[model samples]
Target: MKILIDINHPAHVHYFRHFARIMQSYGHETLFVSRNKEMAQRLLALYNIPYMDRGKGRDSRLGKLMYLIYADYQLFKISAAFNPDLYLNFLHPYPSQVAALLGKPSLVFSDTEHASLHHKLTVPFATKVYTPACYKLDLGQKHVRFNSFMELSYLHPNYFTPNPAILDVLGVQPGEKYAIVRFVSWAAAHDFDHTGMSAANKLKAVQTLAGHAKVFITSEGALPTALEKYRISIPVDKMHDAIYYSSLVFGESATMASEAAVLGTPAIFIDNDGRGYTDEEERKYGLVFNFTESNADQLRAIDKAEAILSDKDAPQKYKHLRETLLADCIDTTQFMVNQALQFSTAHPDPVMPVNS
Candidate 1:
């Protein structure tokens, strides 16, 4: 089978790379399509896969609209030529739109709940929509709920062994403790201004956490001068290693927060947003804390830190829970690939998203 995977962000590359590899391992020809954004190219370059860059335009609304329009046209031209058997990627409208046009069975994977705009653009066209059960989207019949997150499948212990080789790559010793902090540019078109931490707040958080442990900051936007003082020793290229070995993670980026949790690190999501997927993941698996941005005061964080450290059993407990949760869940990549195969076999021509 010929397969194509689309990546809109750097993290998406991490989440989907394993799946693409599995497909290739099974003798399927795989292609990766990516937007020229952030470190997306940097990360995807690690894999030996064919890929194309869908260059982005200005960041403004009109600019993004123009980018999407131009990119979608380009995508259509590419899809017509590649003629993939399966089109898999994040819940992006453009790729799905092209897949619909080319009659290729498409699968969209997303954990985002507040997807009103996503639904308006992509749902009607996708062949299947897979999400964590806790996701808030109303897909009616097309929704396929899973108990696990995309993070757990790829980052879980079964599939992920802490490649200490990664530590060598980052030049970090085995036992050094560090905290990873992430900041999102709420300026993105889809960001919705929901990022609870401002540049000033991030500086303060990094400074306070740095008092206890070495800190590494990863942000979608440039860091402030005060925060940039603690430059990450590990190149942005090897961030996952730093993340995997981190003692703790404090971030507003849901994806990284969940990634840390799956790595069995103490992850704190400091955002005003409450009880979202990360929050639920923390409750279901004991590796994380969802601190409301309002209550993420320094004092509160100190207490949470103390609790995580004081409980000698906490990490072990979360690891146990992660293992158990994973045992009950399907191999997400295999599941996705199998779904694509089945869809293509059942419907030679692309059908509208199931239940649409």
Candidate 2:
């Protein structure tokens, strides 16, 4: 079977990288088409996954609409030639749109419950939409629930192993304690009204957390001069290893927070609207702490981070919690591959591209 996967974000690359390899090992063909957003294209190159560039996305409303049309046309052309048996993505609209035009099924995976605009634009065109069982909103009949977090697709023990060499690279000793702090650019469609930690809070969080443990900031946007020294410079692919070895993670990114939580590192996620998966991680496994972007809540989040850092047994405790989480969840990459193969087998006939 031939499969075409669209990548819109760096995280989407990780979500499907393992799946693509596993599919190929089974003697199937896989094609990746990606937007040159942030590190998306670079990561594809790093992983040696050949992909077609779908152009860098735009930020303005009118520019976004234009890019949407441009991306659809580009993908349509690529799909026409590739003639893939199925389409897959992380809730990206272009694949669903192009797949519909090409008369193929598109399977979309999403764990973000608050991406209403994205859902409105993409869900109607998707063949089936998959989300974690803990997702808050229901997508009616097309909705398929899974028993795992999206981060597990790559971070699961079966797929990922932490490299202690990262410690030497970071100039930290074997037993040193450090924290990974993340900040998002707030540029996505779903992030329209959402806000994360304020500038003052960002400074405060870094300063306070630094006192407790060595701080490393990873921001999508430019960091303030005062905080520049704390910025982390590591290979993009080794980020998971950094998180795995961190004593705590304090950030405005839900994805990073979930990544840290699943890796047995406690994460404090701050945002006005929280993700369903992060909420579940906080409530069920106690590996993540979710906080609103309010002033009071941000302070509380920092306090929680410091408290966790102060505890000598926090790492062991979170490690135990992570084991329970792993035991409860499925290997997401295998599950995704299984779903695609089963879906393709059920609809054995190849979808012929319609004449434009």
Q: Which predicted model would earn the best TM-score? A: 2
Residue-by-residue lDDT tens digits, candidate 2, 270-305: 988899999999999999999999999999999999
Cα lDDT tens digits, model 1, 168-246, are: 6555577655677777776555666565665566666676776666777776667777777666666555566677777
Query: Where does model 1 exceed 4 Å of error?
Result: 165-173, 274-276, 295-321, 344-356
TM-score of each: 0.87, 0.96
Q: What is the lDDT of residue 241 in candidate 1?
A: 64
lDDT of 1: 0.70
Range of the 10 consecutive residues with the lowest summed lDDT in candidate 1: 347-356
